[model samples]
Target: MNIIALEALTFGLGRLAAASRKHGCSLTLFTRDKTVYDYELSLLDEQNIKVVEIDTFDDHAVVEMIRNEKDVVALLSSTDTWSLHCLDVSKSLGLPAQNADAVRIARDKYQLRNRLYEAGLSSAKSQLVDPRKFDNESVIKDISYPCIVKDTAGTGSQNVWIAYDKEDLLQTLDKAAQEVLRGQIAIEPFFSGTLYSLETLSWKGETRVIALTSRITSQEPYFREEAFSSPVTINHSISAALEVWIDNVLKSIGYGNGFAHTEFMITDTGFEVIEINPRLGGVQIGEALCQSLDINIYEAWIEMALNKRPALMDVPLNIHKGIGQLIIYATETGEFSHIEGLDRLSAHPGSPRFYPTAYSGKSISTIVDQRASIGILLAEGETSEVALLNVFAARNKIRVVMKG
Candidate 1:
């Protein structure tokens, strides 16, 4: 079997590539030529994963190359741009794939919010504003205070801003205009709650929740994720209600195939759908799920895409261990020096998994979103509390030193 992955340099890409090898499938990775390619080549070499350079998604030559690739069973991508490209190519080739409209709705925050409102799946009030017309008082009047301004199709929380009052909102709008934001931007009332994500696999509208994760984000007004703990077991009643809500949201959004990383805000009143990402949850969520569930989700996704069959993994009735993931970000702007407490962190009893993404001697600035992540740390323990504690301890022990 053969699978084609586009822009496949995500943190989980290595594991996915390993899984493909283990499953006796040949993997071909297609990525654009860029400076980042330098960092990716070594990882690809380490995995023995094949890499193909493409200037564009569907240039005649690239399409010809894709068509000639033998025994192509499925297409995989973790990034938004290439995932949509995969969908387009899948459509062109008459392969099983997600609907283009579904992918669009999943990627565009404004479309997602509008569709949810139209389908009565959403309760939050939101508006799509033209960045050029952001200065109009009439347009800004409708948006309530304590709202969030976000790019329509952005990922990793880029160009996201929180407004606590009208002054802040106006200032944020000015910033957006100066940034020359692309497409329409969304403004929605910010909800205060505990954030959670449902990692699900859907096949022809039949979806199964694979793992439930609880998230910790940087203290707002910047909402970059800081930590995550997976296979979270909520109370039975809450879990049942959330399951129903997630099912309705997924069905309403027209998610029929592949993985959907659905995020939600659970509060005392109820739950509100945040955004439905049409890819696997990035960072170490995949790693945590693999550890807690004892299954390779990427490999399962490949098999499901090719065979159109449900993936049945050997999930124990009770998952006793908790896997926690922490993303370490730069606290100050300066040249990168070195990380502290590597030896102590590694030798800790929890046996945490660590991978630093930043290079020494490279410059780093304050992290406002997921893109600024310097490194990732994972720790597993007997329970969620223990895992979280160990992860927190490890994170505190390991500090990213910035040169003066």
Candidate 2:
């Protein structure tokens, strides 16, 4: 049997491939651009995974190709861009799938906010703004100052802005008006606190909080992710509280199966919902989880596709060492040259390893978001805190040299 992935995260293909083999299936990935997986593909063999180049956005073409394939057991997708499309294809093929309506709500930021607010799970409500017919006065009146403005379906922090005052809000809205958006523009009150993600798994309405991943982002107004560490240490009381709260949040959205990378803030009031991704956390998060938990986390993805309980649910989470990942960004936008100070990594504590996201000669036009990131530097330590410190120290030695 074969397991089909519509599209996957930049990392974790090898783990997914191995997991598929463990379940007696070969992994086939359908993607429009194979080069996106260059770093991951270089590490794998054909027997473990096969990559088929196709315009995955063409729904009819993908469905036809799946029909022609032999012995297809399950279809899956773990990307924000392809999640809904994958669900549609699965439904058309009479394959097991998550609730389409639920996934729809999860994908739209406005809808998700409203749903949570109506369910009494969210403190702030979101207001949808039509960028073309934007009324700055009305939006300000509804949401007030110190609010967040973002594309309802934005990803990778591409179209997110924080408007602290009138001028900032107007400028942000005007900027948003000039750009094409994936969904409607949404404005919500900004919550001030540290940000973290709950890596969770759900099966048949039951959920498990696998681990907590701490996030560090670029300074105010620009929310580019800078680093991450998994298995954050929290007291038992807070951990239990988060588990219950996340369970309530997921249940409100009708998300009953699959992995959820749920981002939130622990404000002075309580836990507030940021966004929920119905997939594994991206950017070497799978690697961090694997190292911290000492298990191949992707196996759960295969199990869920087959409509069976995720084996990870029953496995005891024996945390080994904490893992931290730092995103290496170019200081200036230009043609990718090479990363300097690689040799120095060997001298750094925590056994730091670098994973390149961009290759030499690739044009880099921006250094404001994930686009500017050239590679990731990962390391391990005795605890998540120490791991984070180790990765940051290692990251300090590296520089992304770009040719102007």
Candidate 3:
């Protein structure tokens, strides 16, 4: 089978490349020249993955290229910006795909919230404010205090802020307005609880949930993720309740064939949707899921693209050990000179897998969003606690040296 992957920035590129090689399938990657970094280009070169550059904004050009691929069996992308394009191209080429409108509903936070609210499903009370014309007095009266203000189309927690009072709320809006587009910013009454991710793979509207991951984020007000571990030990009833709720959400959105990564909170009131990403989790979450469950979701995704329901291996419900991913963010502002910790962490018993995004002489800053993340660390152990301990211990051993 021949598969064309759009937008190589997503972590899925490497995984998809591996899966293609394993399945004896050919893969081609399409990337926008301006958006992809030099290092990413080199990695694609080393992997012998073909890279084709085109203007992503040119819809006619994109459609022409998709139509030109003679033996293309599937068109896929794990990026938010290019998702609708991929789906539309696939639909034009007569391939199986999710509803374009449904995917938009999943990607747009305000739409998702309103849809859930209309359906009587649990969701945060949110209001949208025009960033350009946002007035504190009028907006404040509309929304409750202690709510979160976020860019309506923001991702990776780049433009998300929490406001505990009126002053904080005004300040947050002032900062967020500069980052978001002209559209309204979403302000929602905060829901407090433990956060978890529910991952699913769907085939023709039949959803099969594969993993339930427990997430740890930086302390209140910011949504920057610190770590994630899976096979989260939840009681059967709680798991069942969450799964049922997620299924209803997916059904309501008309989620068809593809992967859905939904993050929700287990609150005192009930389960509230955080965001429903219509793609695989970024970072090493996919890798963590593979390690924890011993199932290759990327391969399954490819198989599903070929109109075959992948026979996912039946992983035992009770996993003795936990598999986790820890992200290391830059703590200083300067040019990244070098790092001292890989050898130490590698030699340790943790069996860590490290992916360093910052190279020597690269500019670094205090991480406020996922883009500022400098590296990632992966570890596993006999228990969730043990796994987390190893991860933190290894992180403590490393020092990210920066040049002032």
Candidate 4:
């Protein structure tokens, strides 16, 4: 049997390929650009993993390709960009899949906020704004100052803006008007607090919190994800409360199966919903889960795709260690050069491993968001806090060189 992926995250392709083989299936990935997975592909064996270059965004082309495949058992997509499209294709072929309507709502931030607010799960409600047509009067009347402006279907923090005052809001609106957005612009109250994500797995409506990751972002105006650490430690009572809250959040959205990466904030009042992704967390989050829980988490993706219950749902999760990942970004936009101080990682305490996301001779642009990231450094320690510190120490030694 063969398991096909519409597209996948930048990392974890190797593990997914291995998981498919473990389940007696070969993996075929359809993507417009194969270079996006260069880091993962370099480490994977080609015998069981196949990468086909095509316009994945072309629905007709993707469906036709899948139709021609032999013994296709499952269709999988663990990305924000293609999860909904993957669902449609899977359903058309009578393959097992999640609720398409639920995925749709989850992918739209404007809709997701309203759903959560209507369910009384969130204190803030979102307003949809046309970037080109929206006026300051209407925006100020609907949302108060210090609100957030972002693409309803954005990923990787590509178009997020924080408007602290009237001038800032107007400037942001003007800036947004000039850019191409993946979805409608959404304006909502900004919730201030520490940012965290809950990595979860659900089977038949039952959700389990696998691990908690702390999201560290760059300084204000640009929410570039700088670093992440998994299995964050929290008080027993708060952790219990979050478990209940997340279950309710997922239930409200009708998310029944697969992995969910729910980002939320612990505000002074209570926990607030940021957004929920209906797939595995991106970057090295899957790797972090595997290292902390000591299991092949991607195997669960294969299991779920085949309509079988994930064994991970039943296994006892005893976190052995903490995992930290730091995104390495270039200081300027230009031609990519070599990364400096990688040789010093071997002397670090956490056994740091460097994964390059960009290669030499590639053109680099936009240093604001995840687009600027060239690589990621991962490390481990006794706890998530220590792991973060260790990764930071390793990061301090590395410098991304760019020639403009």
Give me the runs in candidate 2 sitting further than 4 Å from their true place. none
Higher-lDDT candidate among 2 and 3? 2
The sequence of per-residue lDDT tens digits that candidate 2 reaches over residues 1-404 is: 88899989999999999899888988999999988899889999987898888899998899999998889988899999999899889888988888888888999999999999999998879998887787667877856779999999889878999998888888888899998798889999899888999999999999999999999999987999999998998989999999999999999999998899999999899999999999999889988999889999899999888877888999999989999999988888779999999999999999999999898998988889898889899999999999999999998898888776
Tens-place lDDT per residue, model 4, 54-169, is 89988788888998988998899999999878987887788888888889999999999999999999997999888788666877785677899999999998999999988888
Residues 138-182 of candidate 1: C-alpha lDDT, one tens digit per residue: 667867778999888777767889998888887788788776454
TM-score of each: 0.91, 0.98, 0.90, 0.98
Among all windows of 10 consecutive residues in model 4, the one with the lowest summed lDDT is: 134-143
lDDT against the true structure, per candidate, is 0.76, 0.91, 0.75, 0.90
Query: RMSD in angstroms, all models?
Result: 2.6, 1.1, 2.7, 1.1
Model 3 Cα lDDT, one tens digit per residue, 1-404: 67888774445466677777787777877777623445445556455566678876566787788677668788777877777777777777787666788898887788888888888786545678876676668888856667888766667777788999888888777777677452358888788888988888777777777778878898776789888877676789987887788888898878866788898888888998888889777777787776666656688767776777766533354464677678888777778776676888767665877776666777765576776677788888876657777887788788778786
- Candidate 4 ranges beyond 4 A from true positions: none
For model 1, where is the 10-residue window of minimal lDDT?
308-317
Clashing residue pairs in candidate 4 are none
Error of 4 at 57 (Å): 0.3
Worst 10 residues of 3 by lDDT: 34-43
- How many steric clashes between backbone atoms does each model show? 0, 0, 0, 0
lDDT of 2: 0.91
